[model samples]
Target: MFYEIVTSPCYGTVEKVAIDKDSRIYEWEPLFAIKNMNGELEVIKMGCSGEVQSLEVEAGDKVIPGMVLAYIQEDILIGGSD
Candidate 1:
């Protein structure tokens, strides 16, 4: 099953894509800054606080729902033997 992650609070552009499966970190990067509710600009590191499987799109990609931007490789075995 694939999930769609929306852009939170609306921002300029996506800087990077982070992938995480089953609470395990797979990839990460520094994302572009976004203006919060308080009107403050802030750059958020992708997947800094939550478990993400994979990013659907890339940097500067216009995104919408029902779009298969990226994919998550599920069923990864432990001990790095997949």
Candidate 2:
């Protein structure tokens, strides 16, 4: 099973897959600014606000949507390892 990791639609750019010994993902930044007919400075901050959790699946690991990836629990529960 393969899980499709996707970003929210609110994100203007899609994450790019980096080909390297250590697979890294990155997203392109969009240029956004507010200006009148005449050049003027304006506040503009465009980007996604969230954390990308590290997945349990490695380079060649098979994973399903419902499969347990990683625990984000505040307290470690005993006998929780499956």
**TM per model?**
0.31, 0.22
Local lDDT at 60 for model 1:
58
- State which candidate has the highest TM-score: 1
Candidate 1 structure quality by residue, lDDT tens digits, 9-76? 44334444444333433334433344444556544443433345655456555433344533333333
- Quantify how close model 1 is to the true structure by its C-alpha RMSD in Å: 7.6
Per-prediction count of colliding residue pairs?
2, 0
Per residue, candidate 2 scores C-alpha lDDT tens digits across 1-82 of 2222332222122122222222332333221222322344222222322223443433333333244332121222258666
Q: What is the lDDT of residue 59 in candidate 1?
A: 59
- Per-model lDDT: 0.43, 0.28
Q: Clashes in model 2: which pairs? A: none
- The C-alpha RMSD in Å for every predicted model, in order, reads 7.6, 14.0
Leading candidate by lDDT: 1
